[model samples]
Target: MPVRTADAALAGVRRGVGAERLTGRTALVTGSSRGMGRAAAIRLAQEGALVAVHYNRDEAAAREVVTSVEKDGGRAFAVRGELGVDGDVDGLFAVLEEDLRERTGSTDLHILVNNAGVMGGVGADEVTPEQFDRIFAVNAKAPFFLIQRALRNMPDGGRIINISSGLTRFANPDEIAYAMSKGALEQLALHFAKALGPRRITINSVAPGITRNGNPVFDIPEVVEQMAGLSAFGRVGEPEDVADVVAFLATDEARWITGSFVDATGGTLLG
Candidate 1:
């Protein structure tokens, strides 16, 4: 069955659901200048949450997202910081704090979406120490520390959503390092879920399949067709496809779901 829109499903919720479902809520989405991060940030703002759009080096793209969010009657701001640096995580949160205070009069962060990642194409034999370190630094280390920082401002019922890749399950030889990093993130999700369970905070990972988000991986027509065929749905995944799942997980509707890896991979792993 298809899910109904807020307007069609619950008239009462649409009529007077004060931003509590997301109104006063604040969210931080890293790598949100484009792709999955951009989609997720916009979706969160549409649902009433104030958004903090974080980008690594794309100031213009980040600002564009913030502008789009604001144009839609949502509140958003952009922050720049490299993931995995010692003070970078702190700087990102510091900006988040400032944005939250300016928008909601509080520094309380309610949602943290660790969506920044890099794919390493090095095979096992070609994988360099630097390549491995770089992938893990962004995919694993940055998210772990960001979670630690998010927890300080996140009270009970806070949400932490991590983005992983379906490569972790298929384990392609070319993306060993990237897969490994994502696999570690899945494990981190489980651990954080257990650690934060007592406080009612939810931590989960969303693994995407071969999503054609203007990434170089899908540049070749043959490769794109192969990826489309890999999914049981017979199509490549879209950013909005994954964004919808992320938005669902952020809602009160997903209160019972946590410590889990929800495969938003369009049935790519089924075959």
Candidate 2:
């Protein structure tokens, strides 16, 4: 058979045999009001998992995501939470627990995607202690505690996917604090995988390169073009690109894949 034809056949087989992969599963995706998080939540729901659409401050945006998911015949609801704060995290869980009970009569969660993050690059000299602390609180500490809370409600075969960045591998001179925070997240994935292995829970990280959203960084045509050039694919990635991988990870098809960092970076880390 031709290579392309053979590849197509294999893909069909995988899809057909994947066991209704994520059907009846429940997922939580933080920072899902827009961008990558929103894409991931929708993808997971499309793949048959009930999704919890999480947002920090954008209630309307979060509701919009939920509405879109439901319109597509998927299960989803907006849940508000501030990633870097304790009270907000606790309250988020409380609401999630209640929602879960109403929907499925169970508090168990199957997948947790730590997709919330903030990016602000400052020179080392300009980085203040407060700035560093906030970055860590959101990018590192929040995920840690969220994972801890998730594991309590997750059963065997559950998954935890942390969203990291390419900066962890390549140095960005101006992103001192942001890079450091992602580095910490990378470590958390490895250690959490080990810690959760006994329960058959898998933990991993998905690191992305510069991608366009409504963010100002990608607003300039020249800057967008420059970002595309950084990748071997010669194009910046789309939210859907990252979402596809995350949806797969949440399925039983990836049960054996754990403690790994999957690069959805459009080959930006490639030399």
Candidate 3:
């Protein structure tokens, strides 16, 4: 279908979403209080989904995200639960159900964005059992179990996007545990793609490379240039860069894509 004119394109786009791009859908983006997850939550709301902004300890930040969404004339709410702890998933969903039902009259989730994760804990040689377990607990175990619980409420044609990293595809010894956990998460997507195909549910991983998620490391000019030089575009990624890919996956336009690793790396793998 060729889009003819500017006005026609605008009309077509508005019609596609019935309001924006994800209207009548409900999305829950974890770790949404800040960073890439926060960008995804806001993007989903802009596209017309009723967003559940999940946070760990920053209620103010979470509420701020909700406020931002509402300020843009979108609907959103906050759900708080610290991941990587026992009964964490249960507590997360308890808040999700009560809050979601109160707003939308149903607890069904159409999109689940597993963006909450941990990066650094300890170097491998200095890695203790507690360190390893905590890494996997937050990065791997939390998403694994969160999906298990979300499946009961997620209906057919639901979308599950796991936020992965470019490190999994390359050799990065510094973040070994973090990369391994993301690898495990990709495997979950591969296996579940077939497992959930019968239900028309799509699961995929979006791997980002050297993203500028408001970290102070990028604040240094030399560090910023060094990171940007790694990409073929000679630029680092922004939170919205990854969030755009994730937002596309949440829509019906990406229905054909599943069980794949989307490289949102700006050509960082071109070596």
Candidate 4:
């Protein structure tokens, strides 16, 4: 079988012609220039949400996402900010708010997806203090503060979704640092769900396992088949597989669901 791209995974979903469940709402998805973030941004836009595509440095790729959204009659623009750095969250919202206000006459964000993360591929012994710090800073600290800042303008009935990892539940020695970072991320949803409940703003964490993310390894059939076996369905998880779940959480129908860690891992390691 041939390798499948993210777009191919979304082929079945009707774009520019759907329920428009998120009409008039505004969403910001970080690290959306590629992979699952890109898929979520598109999926939300398909449901009629004006999306802000955030990227660290890939302006060209970000533009491509914006273009793709606009081509389908959806509204989208790109914003850039490197996570894990001082003033990263502040700088990101500065641009995001300005663009939002200019377009909709309001700075209220309806959905926030904390998806940008770094995977420090090092075992426990080989991982350095600096490596651990950076990983936590990006995967944990940044999302924590991003939510803090987003609350300033996020209206009641808003949605906040953080992209976690299956490594938190399963074990991967080489990804110990990365998994720990995601574990910290999961804690955010657990506590915030209660805190934000009164305001009707839902917060949840989504954990995906062994997803195909445009990595060259996925291009090789042998590697693909081996990884496919990890899933109960005998297939690798697609970006859309995870994005569809994020999109559902952002809808009004999910108002009662909060502070949950959704397993988007395709039942990985369920044997």
Candidate 5:
């Protein structure tokens, strides 16, 4: 089986997530310049939320996302700050709050999607202390702090979604450190859902497996087939697949659900 190109895979799969269920709401998706983050940003905007497209260094790509959202008749803006660095969250929120206050006359954020992460530190033997620290810093610490700051302005009944990975549930020795980092990320949802319950804020983690994100290896038929077979659906996961889940979590439909690990993995490795 040939690997499905991104265009082909998304051709029919892309559509509006809701009929303005999130109208008048504001969302911030981190690392949204490309991949799942880009897709999630677009999906949230489609639901009528004013989106904040956050990027680390790709200002051009981030601008494109803002343009895409605008072209779709939705409102969006781009914010830049490199995660895992000192003052990253503060710097990001500065620009974000400025935009929010200017646009809506308020700094209230309704949804926060912690989608930014690093994916190195391969295995135990190959992993170095530097890599482990960086991985945890980006994947775990950054989101932890971002949530800490977001809650201040996030109103009651807000939604917080952390983009996690299937490696947290399934074993992947090759990604030991990365998996550990994501595992720590999952704990954020579990713990915060309880702590923030009084405020009616719901926090959850969405785990995706072997998602295609424009990687060159996915262009190879053999590699695609091998990965596709791992999923119960007999196809590789697409960004839209997980983005839909993220959008749902942000909606009122998922209000009863919190402190959950949602499997957006195309049923990967389910015998």
Candidate 6:
């Protein structure tokens, strides 16, 4: 009966103060200015996480996300850093630490979601070395270093969730670099899970297929219909769809699962 914003979805958590699932935890979500990252950050906030919404260029959008979370009766702050650039990971942490110490009185972190990335649609024959380098820098290298740096501040039972893609399993030559980066992310999770298992920290990847990530195709009726037909549900996946999966992975209920590539593709890989 009403149009629901991301903040509206989080109102359920406001039924009672301190009734949320992650009341004392802190989460940092990269590229949270829009799309799946935005939804994931908001949902985590709904569960009572003090979310650090990170963005590169769109400071306005990042502030919007923080506002949305705050409006939902949750806590969030915006952090900025250009990913894929040198010192990006450390730069992000520096700003975040200052904010945390000022606001929460501590720089400790519990959850790290690597969601900022670049998508390349260049085919092998046409892709240049520069494009390949940029894609890997943003999609793979950034996450790797981010996790490496986060482990220091992260305590036991922390969660590291990397946003991957179902493209790794499907053959899409136009996006080969993007797919390869996701594969590398899965492998990173596989190894990191073991490395952090002693601390009870879990690392995993959530791979989604063809979700509305600022893609104009979803706006065109004919194109949307064709893409929806690809899924068993006969509908396109939304940002919230993958956000829910990422949120689950960050929760204690998903403690048993680690080093796994979860298919959040809406059964896109089923058939």
Most lDDT-accurate candidate? 4
Candidate 4 residue-wise lDDT, 81-152, digit = tens: 999999999999999999999999999999999999999878799999999999999999999999999999
lDDT of 2: 0.83
User: What is the lDDT ranking, best to worst?
Assistant: 4, 5, 3, 6, 1, 2
TM-score result, candidate 4: 0.95
Candidate 3 ranges beyond 4 A from true positions: 1-19
Candidate 6 versus the native: TM-score? 0.93
RMSD of each: 5.0, 4.9, 5.8, 2.1, 1.9, 3.6
Candidate 2, residues 1-271, lDDT tens digits: the string is: 1111112333423231234468888999999989999989988888878899998888999999999988877789988877787675778899999999899999999999999998767888888888888999999989888887887899887999999998988888899789899999988878888888888888899998876567786667677767777787676777777887888888777889888988888889577
- On lDDT, the stronger of 1 and 5 is 5
Off by over 4 Å in 1: 1-20, 216-222
Candidate-wise lDDT, in order: 0.85, 0.83, 0.87, 0.92, 0.92, 0.87
TM-score of 2: 0.91
Model 4, runs deviating above 4 Å: 1-16
Each candidate's number of clashing pairs is: 1, 0, 0, 0, 0, 0
- Per-residue lDDT value at 84 in model 2: 86
C-alpha-based local distance difference test score of model 1:
0.85
Comparing candidate 5 with candidate 6, which one achieves the higher lDDT? 5
Over 67-175, each residue of candidate 3 has an lDDT whose tens digit, in order, gives 9989878899999999999999999999899998999999999999999998864567877778788889999999999999999999899999999989898877778
Candidate 5 Cα misplacement greater than 4 A, ranges: 1-10
Per-prediction TM-score: 0.90, 0.91, 0.92, 0.95, 0.95, 0.93
- State residue 7's C-alpha deviation in candidate 2, in Å: 18
Better of 4 and 6 by TM-score: 4
Candidate 5 matches the true fold with a TM-score of 0.95
lDDT per residue (tens digit) for residues 1-271 in model 6 = 2222223444444332354778889999999999999989988998889999999889999999999889878999999999998989899999998988887899989999999989887888898989999999999999999999998899899999999998988889899988998899889889998888999999999998878878777778778777777776666787888888888889899999999989888778577
The alpha-carbon deviation from the true structure for residue 107 of candidate 3, after best TM-score superposition, in angstroms, is 0.6
Q: How accurate is candidate 6 locally (lDDT)?
A: 0.87
